[model samples]
Target: MPAARGGRWGRLPERRARQLQRQMQAKEERIAELETENAVLHLRLAQRLRLAGTAGTRWREGLPQRTRSLLRLQQAAQRLRQDLRELRAASADLLGSCRDQQQDSLSRILAAVQSAQHHGALPSWRARALRLEQSLQELSARFHRERQRRRRLHNRLVELQGNIRVHCRIRPAMPAAAEPPDPVSHSSSASGDVAHAVDDETVLVRCSRPGHHAVHKTFHFERVYGPAEGQAAVFADVCPLLTSLLDGYNVCIMAYGQTGSGKTHTMLGPRPPGAAQADTGLIPRAAEELFRLLSEDPSERPRVEVSVVEVYNNDIFDLLAEDGCAERPGLRREVLTTREGRKAVSPLTCLPVGSAGELMELVGAGLRLRARRATSVHADSSRSHLVVTVTLTAAASRDGTPEPRSSPSPPQAPSCPSPSPPATGRRPRAPRRASSGSPGAPPESPARPAGQVRARLQLVDLAGSECAAASGARGPALREASFINRSLAALADVLGALAARRDHVPYRNSKLTHLLQDALGGDAKLLVIVCVSPHRQHVAETLQSLGFGARARQVERQGGRGRPAPRGPR
Candidate 1:
């Protein structure tokens, strides 16, 4: 029995030892599997997921086994439980770390993709912007080329027409509700008045008459303006004339109409601040455009001079007369003639102008000094004719000779009138007031030089034709009206003679005609802007005005037959 007990105890020790070995082997295998998974996760997730070092190299190698005498199988089972808990904790931590790293890697990859997309699109946007700029440049070039071609055609037409252009503008009629009763309206009935613009260049007038069938008359012209048009639109038609003046041709622009017409308004515009820049008149706008053209070529700084004159009561007065000028401004006959026989009336005030603002100042002063009167026909009637002359002289050539200019061409068969399209305009920019210098600055530019091609531009504002009876004139007013009528009649005679191919144009018949002799007889370009009233009361005067315009048009037709044409190359 003792022998049997000893053998059983020995076998029990062996069994326990084998059991311990089996448990150690299982723990080792589990640790190895966890380590391998951690390694793979670290590589896949890169730096984001990292596993902690094993508890110690000894634990990884193998734990020492306990003897049956020191440690029982139950104690071994408890140790195994502790090791299992520790391994599970480590594995849980590793899994949490790997999940966080994976999330971070996904975010980084998304950001990289977005950055690549943005960089790739940069060149496409830049190329589109470049194309827009190139297109704008090309359009600008094409516009300028087309404008040059148009200018050439305009010059040809102007020369072929004998440098004379006739344009008629009809004043708008006041609504019957707003218009006062016509003091001079004849033929009983005050209604049934019609004024129609038959075409762009034709105006038809019809009115009721007690003893006759409805009177009808038609007037034809080169250009016409309806009431809806504004100052800017009218100026566009005159824009090409400026280019001609710049090429060294004398230009005359005259407004003719009865009293209360819009001649003053057309020539000078409404009083300054009350009007918008786009509403300003032709003279001011011309000055602005002229300066802009000059600025284009800074190398040739040209000089500009201006003079203002008024013809009142058959007498000439220099609105800008100097301190040592003629004895009496209104009666002065002082005249100046250059060696080349270019005639200009002297004793008139002449001002050196560098900018449009300065020119306007002089003009305002002249307006104040001009003779005016209030008549029954108009609240503020112009009693005198005003002529504002602007002279431009180009810079001399480097060879001390005048630059070649386009000389006027001889009168030929009338060129087919080109129908001018109605102009579209925008708000004009306000111009900077140009002065000589600082408040008291030095000369803005050099003095006028010789050997330069000089050209003249005249803006003539004629007083409205007055009805002695309707205006209720007496005393000096009546005398003034008579003088105005006589002078206008003489002007008509001059036009008729020119149209008839007479030897003399009778330019000396009146002071107004005498002063316009050079413009009428020479190769100077002339533009007559006939202003007509649409009021029923002014029917007779309107007819007379239309007759005058027709004669002027005839003069234009024959190239001002009495006037001589230019010779030699321009």
Candidate 2:
């Protein structure tokens, strides 16, 4: 039934149905729109979700880096706090140190103030010290005076004993030869102190050999000279002996040694023009000293006369004789006995020496004469023994004292006019060195003695004792060497006898001894300069020379008494 009804209605409502279906379709389309809108909203929401997720992932990755930065800032803040704490502590320590230093400075200042407060007593102490120094000075002055007095007394004592004193002098060794193969043999031994000076009084000589034990000897003397010593040193020790001559004493100075051992050099010294006055030999210095001493007291000085002689081949020749200068040729011998048993040269040119210069001239003249014609070991060698006499006689003065005759109006001696060449000497016997007499003066008396203080100072340069074989001599030089050795032996004998205090001496042994008889035997002060070569090669001759010195020393030690010269008018 319902179906029939529905069909009937359906047929009647076709138009209406169509309209209602359209309405339905509209409703369906609306639904589809709603679904599509929803789908679109969902797609947009998914895209927003994807973007938020990516932003969250980025935040997560950056979180650790930010955390690490915060941690580093915290650590830096901690370090800053630590540094401030240390600064605070250091400030405290510096304040404490300053306090301590201030206290120390205060203490030092207090100490200085206290010292200054106690300075009132220094003046008294200083005054006391000055007084003590004054007293000490006075004592020193007194001691000096006493020493001087003692020295004077001792000099007088030594002068009174007219003994022969020996002084040894050692010359310096010259440059050695080119180094020899065996220098030990030519060299001085280690024990060369055999010539060593222990003091002013003692000398030691030590000897040693390869197979033999060392042997030594010691000698005593008044003075000794070493290689380093010079002429001034020797003269200093001898000055006292010279002073004795001024006090009215006879003095004889003799130099003896072997050939080439400084014998001539010690007496006459090196040739002039090259040497100085202070370094001249004993003879020149002695003359100069005489003039100086006389000048000190001219009113009391004695008249001086000089004569030079030479003993060649045991024959005495007057160096200032008239023979060589005036044609009275042959050598003049010494007159054996004179007025008072004295020795005098027959034709001695007793020239009056006014000054030291004149004395030097005479010496030069005598040297020239010696070199004129001579045979010698050395060209300038003194082949003959030289004897220079400086005779002093007291001249009358207003006060009865001695006076040196200064008058230049006296005559010349050994008259020679228009003298020859350099070989001949000028008139040596002039009354005075500065005398205004003729150049050709004649020989005259020795001197006019107002008082008897007759003193003869003889400077004897003995010919050296050398071996003939060593000298290479053929005739005259060999003969001269023999005579020299003989005369030296004679001298040694004389010294030995004097040392033994014998009653008689062998004065007649040789011409030299005979000529010096009076000066040797009498109470004459004698000085011997024993010159020696400091060479090992000269050991033999050195021993001989030293032995001679020893004997001479014995003579003095054994009381070789001397008589002072007569003090009154002759």
Candidate 3:
């Protein structure tokens, strides 16, 4: 069995080898089939991958171009956004400017509409009315433009007709009980009613002596006011001058009369309790009118200053001074002549005033300090000359803003000397600050800088001229009378000199005349209101005053212009 096992084992080994070979072959065929199937699967996978890649490539075709296009679109969109931002910015700017223009245009249209409504044209639907309203609106605008020119022309006309205008006023006859009996003239009538206003322009003085024939004298003046004439009537003629004042002209209105002739009444109006608005005097009335005009256009916001001075016993006193609440003899000032020949007062108290009432209060305060004394001719008489000067300063700005107040400095000379005359319709500009050390040039005032316009309104109430004997003067009264007479004589001399066209006018002869040198020299519009009592006792003074008025009428002066305001942007 062992031998058989060995042989069988060896044969089995061969058999095993052959069996292994067949098994190896079968496994190879199986491996080859598996490899083919695996190769087919690989081919299929490669095809699928190629197809997927091709489809993906086809789907992704023009990706760079599309990306570039998208980038371009984004850039274009960004540019559009930028352009839109720029357009918005531009529109904002345009709108801002247009709004400003529209605001101005709307204001003008509203004014026109209001004017149309005022004339009852707004309610009318008729074509004719509409056309008329349109024409009226146009005319109104034209009139507004021409108004300033008209003012210039009117002022020129006033200058041509004599810059100095004279008016005469007759006071009513005083009660016999009030008049002192004339001891020297016993033959004279008890009631000395002699002066009378014959008409609106004529004054007649009728005097009859016992043995002499009746003597009648008539004087012609610009206007004559009877005692019956109200203050309104007298102011009607003087009202036009206020307009000239606003046109940058210096104006002076003075009252001249004998004692007790009603000058105070006419100038200051009825005293206190008896005084009504209708009976107010020229000073208050003028103040009212001035403020009224300024109120019409508050944008201008013109500045007004007031200074009051009194000439008492040939001495000038600054009534507006700090200690000048009452008649303080120490509150004296010196009148100075500028290099430009204009009069100025140093250390003058010039207070700023806003309204007419405020200005009047100032005036009233000054008047309280004015010199007054009782005389035989009247119970209360003005013993001094009162001068109230109102200065109007108009400042302009390049940027249309209010000017800031500057530090205080010495005031400059107020005279303007232009190289050439202004155009026909244009107003002259305000005086400019002069160069240092130049002729007639003073140091510029901090309050008033360059390119500022100034105008002055001087109101004067002169003390009465009376005979010493008639006034029953003694002691100080006699001295006052003498000085008064001398000043009156000097005034007459100055007027005569002006009338005769004398090259040398004695303006320094008296303090009164010297103080009013500018007004008398024809640089200003001067209005003289001559007041007289309608009584034979005062006939001599009346005649003298009338003669003075006549002389003043003959005095012609060339009017000087103040600086014209600058025109603002329309």
Give the number of the best model, judged by lDDT: 3
Q: Write the per-residue lDDT of candidate 2 for residues 1-570, one digit (tens) a residue.
A: 999998888886888889999999999999999999999999999999999899899989999997898899989989988998998899889988988998999998888767756754657668888999999999867865874565456555775533667898876664454111222354533323235666766666665645555646676767788867777787775566666677666778889888777777778777644577555787777887888877875446566777778777776666654443544333455555654666666645666677888887877767665522233334444567888888776755555545555554445445343433322322233222333222221112334333435677888888777766545665656666777789989988887887788888897898888877666766667888888765554555777888889987776432234345565321
lDDT of 1 by residue, 1-570 (tens): 999999999899899999999999999999999999999987877644333234355445555543443468778889999999999999999999999999999999889878868677757768988999999889967865875566567667676654777777777665665454664453332353455567778989898756546668888888888766788877887777777776556778888888866788787887543588777888888888877886775545556777777777776665554323222233244344545565567433445677888887777767776777767777677777888888765545666534543232232221222233211111111222332312110111222244445678888888778789888878777777787788888888988988898886787678888777767666678888887777776778888888898988877433333332221112
Compared with the true structure, what per-residue lDDT tens digits does model 3 show for residues 1-570? Answer: 999988888897898899999999999999999999999999999999999999889769978888999999999999999999999999999999999999999999999888878866745647777899999999967876887678768777776655799999988766667777755355334356788888989999888766556769989999999988988987887777887777767789999988887787778798662556788888898999899987876556666778888877777766655541222233566677665456876556676677898898878878776766678877777788889988876665777543432333344333322233221211122222222111112111333465566678899988899988788888767777777778888998999999999989999899989888888985688899999988776777988999999999998775464332233311
Report model 3's TM-score to 2 decimal places.
0.65
Every candidate's lDDT: 0.68, 0.67, 0.75
Clashes per candidate, residues 3 or more apart or on different chains = 4, 12, 6
Ten residues in sequence with the least summed lDDT for candidate 3: 435-444
Rank order by lDDT, top first?
3, 1, 2
Candidates in order, TM-scores: namely: 0.61, 0.62, 0.65
Q: State the TM-score for model 2.
A: 0.62
When summed lDDT is taken over every stretch of 10 residues in candidate 2, the lowest stretch is 435-444
Where in model 2 is the C-alpha error above 4 Å?
Answer: 1-155, 159-162, 177-194, 207-215, 276-278, 324-330, 371-379, 397-399, 403-452, 556-563, 568-570
Model 3: residues >4 Å from true position, as ranges? 1-144, 183-191, 211-214, 272-274, 324-328, 399-447, 559-570
